[model samples]
Target chain A: MEVLGIILAGVLVNNFVFMQYLGICPFLGVSKDFDMATGMSGAVIFVITVASTVTAALEQYVLKPLELEYLRTIVYILVIASFVQLVEIFMKKTLPGLYQALGIYLPLITTNCAVLGAAMLNVTKSYGVVLSTVSGFAGALGWSLAIIIFAGIRERWKLMDIPATLDGFPLALISTGLMSLAFLGFSGLFSNLVK
Target chain B: MGDRLLVTPSPHVKSTKTVQGIMLDVVIALCPAAIAGTVLFGFRSALIILVSVASAVASEALYQKAVKRQVSINDFSAVITGLLLALTLPPHVPLWIPAIGAAFAIVLVKQVFGGLGNNFLNPALAARAFLLAAWPLHMTQDWVNPMTYDAATSATPLAGFNATGQTAFTLKQMLLGQRPGSIGETCILALLLGGLYLIVRDIIDYRIPLGYLGTLAIGTWIFGKPGAFFQGDPLGAIFLGGAFIGAFFMATDYVTSPVTPRGRLYMGIGCGLITLVIRLWGGYPEGVTYAILFMNLVTPLIDKYVVPRYYGSGHDKMARKGGR
Candidate 1:
């Protein structure tokens, strides 16, 4: 039940993009088309899940034992970068279609900040390995969900005869703002459930 | 007729302004504040700013090169992002902090989103927000007075107001910028001078800054503190903290803010409301950064919904709908 609370909180109430404002670059950029958005989300989910588990284990077993916790940020960032590179190479070899869809976006995941932010957050908040993995997976899933929904809205929005100034990026930003406000409705759900 | 037929769909008329031009204008506009920061904080501040700007530009350039995309460092957008991020940071922050911030601002917030005009939020502001969240203690640690090197850190005027319910700096002190705050946000006079230059050069439209500051003034006049409401000069509120810097430069970033006049007005009003709310009630003292950033998230929506009516379009239908 407590783990469920963590998952729920990370996924919804404390969503990485809308609520916490992490990973907003991809949230806005890749979200123009639903198909691309889903691909990016899948990539983020895979990277975050693996990165979190590795970071948690490394922080707990290696850094803490060596008293080198201060180097966590540098270490976590490098790990995420290498991991993303590895994923890119592996996907290119084994899964060409998936690789093509996620081609440039794969490298982009290294600096997504959400991935690094989630890894660092896991260590900083002192979540155990299991909880850290769950939080990371949930956070990525939440980001994916938010961006996909936004993509759908933006696609529909293309039909409207938007004004001159507000036509492109401005309209998208305004829609995101409204979506953020709507997401605020879930703020207390986890807290309430925990009690 | 052949050439006309070959023209691309829409955006038929192009402005003289390119992203490079606008970004260069901003960098020029920020020169005054950067000089002021260097003078006030000494060589270290200048070094930090240069490092940040260089690192941001380098990171952006390298990222584009590595990805086999067009290298866009010449646009000067990365420099502006780095400068803005450095200006918002504490003068005494660790060397790695600014480097990290610059890299993030350029690579994560700017380039990864498709570079130049593609970024949805102000890269500098987003980097600052991230640093604030990740390292709150380091980011929030107040600096000793540059003149004294007093070893004892003191709260900023805004923070002082939040804690003790009294501002440390007098209105005059804040106006002259003798008070301690972020490097560039200290002197209202400097910010205003730079802002005026931008306005005069026609580098930026006045709608965003004017609307932002004007609405903030109105909101502060109404709800600033009990007596502050009546006694509080809205102009003072505008001058305090990074309100002026953000309103004029950061909030008006072409890529992140609304393009339409009506959308800009609505964006300004929203920023003002959020800033006032945060300053008055939220835990943070200076809300301008977050307020501007929060509003950046909404610029797309504001542009979509608050579009100006077509030239010569009748308001009768809209007016009747509103009445109903």
Candidate 2:
């Protein structure tokens, strides 16, 4: 039941992109096209999941023992960046088809704040390794859900006769604001079981 | 010969109907509800409506002038948005609530997306949701008893229903707008007349309303009771809240709903499902506002996948992928 709460909170009730305002860069950058957005979603899900598990393990095994809790952010960045590299190489050799679909987005995820944010959040929330992995995957799913829906809407901009200045990010950000306003309906709609 | 085959710009279907004419028809249809709301709630309701519509028109004009775009306030869509937003608010709110809401609707929701036809979300519904979030007490607690004109508490039928799963108001009272709710929401007869007017004039698709109400009725019947099934009052459920107004006016807006018939049906059903979930289990007493807004955002995706099969289209899967 508690696990269900975490998953539900991550995906809908407390979505990272819409609710927490994380990963706005890639969310706005690669969301102009639907397929590209999905590719980015796939990359985010993989990286955030792996990064969450590794960070949780490091927090438990290394940080607490050495009293280096303050170095956690720096250490998580290093872990995420190197893991993205390792995945890029390993996928190129073994899963070349996926590499073709997700390769262009993997490097972009190396510096993504959502992955790092997910790791830092796990530390603060005191989530163990397994729950942290689930939360990471769910948060990425929620982010992916938002961007895909946004990309679906943005694709229609081709059909519309928009203004000169409000063509790209200006319109995108406005739409995001309205969308988050609507998503606010979900905030107190359910119990805060995750906490 | 030249007269018979004139070379006019394309859109050659012969019709006197226009955007302006359709919007005028909507305002006309909304009159009965607006009047009933004013009569039931007193002059305060009328002032709110006027302020909302005026501010909405002003916002559109001012924004267009500031941005050097064509001022399209004469088209009357802003009036309709303002009327709808004001209608959904609790009666006797501060006049500025509707004013601010109207501006938010016109400027942020409608104009930012390049004006009336281009916006995907319903402007009025979005504004109402904004107001509800920004000022929960006024939006929820400002309701008054229909005739006595006093601030109502447990007298609000929807809240009573939400708390006890049972209603003290009779069906006739609920139907006659004798109870307390949002300004336009209390008078079922007036809203129905407006909806019938829209349907008769072909301003809205009938299937959208039918699907929305039908799904809500069935869901209410199936899950309305605490432990029993198929024991809920579908008629009371439809008449108690914004379901009537939402189904007829807001949910069926052509700009935000699907272009295809099948997609509109799905949109209505999706709205009904979400409304049921919220009313039954979620925190809010009414779910129509959020239900409609959520479907409005999903509408583009529905339009994408529910594309009508064109003539001579290939059956090949890869062909379809390449076509999109």
**DockQ list for all candidates:** 0.04, 0.69
lDDT of 2 by residue, B141-245 (tens): 888889898887664677566555568778788778888888998899999999999999988888888999999999988888778888877887788999999
True contacts kept of each: 0.00, 0.55
Q: Could you say which candidate leads in DockQ?
A: 2
Which docking category, incorrect, acceptable, medium or high, applies to candidate 1?
Answer: incorrect
Which 10-residue window of candidate 2 chain B scores lowest in summed lDDT?
Answer: B1-10
The sequence of per-residue lDDT tens digits that candidate 1 reaches over residues B218-283 is 777676655544544575577667788888888887767776767777777777776776666555
Error of 1 at B279 (Å): 1.5
Q: For model 1, what is the alpha-carbon lDDT of residue B15?
A: 56
Write one digit per residue (lDDT tens) for candidate 1, span A121-170. Answer: 88778998998998899889889878876775565445432344445676
**Residues A21-81, model 2: lDDT tens digits:** 8999999888899999989999899889988999999999999999999998789899888
Pairs of residues clashing in candidate 1: A170-B300, A171-B300, A173-B300, A173-B301, A174-B300, A174-B301, A174-B302, A175-B301
The CA lDDT at B309 in model 2 is 65
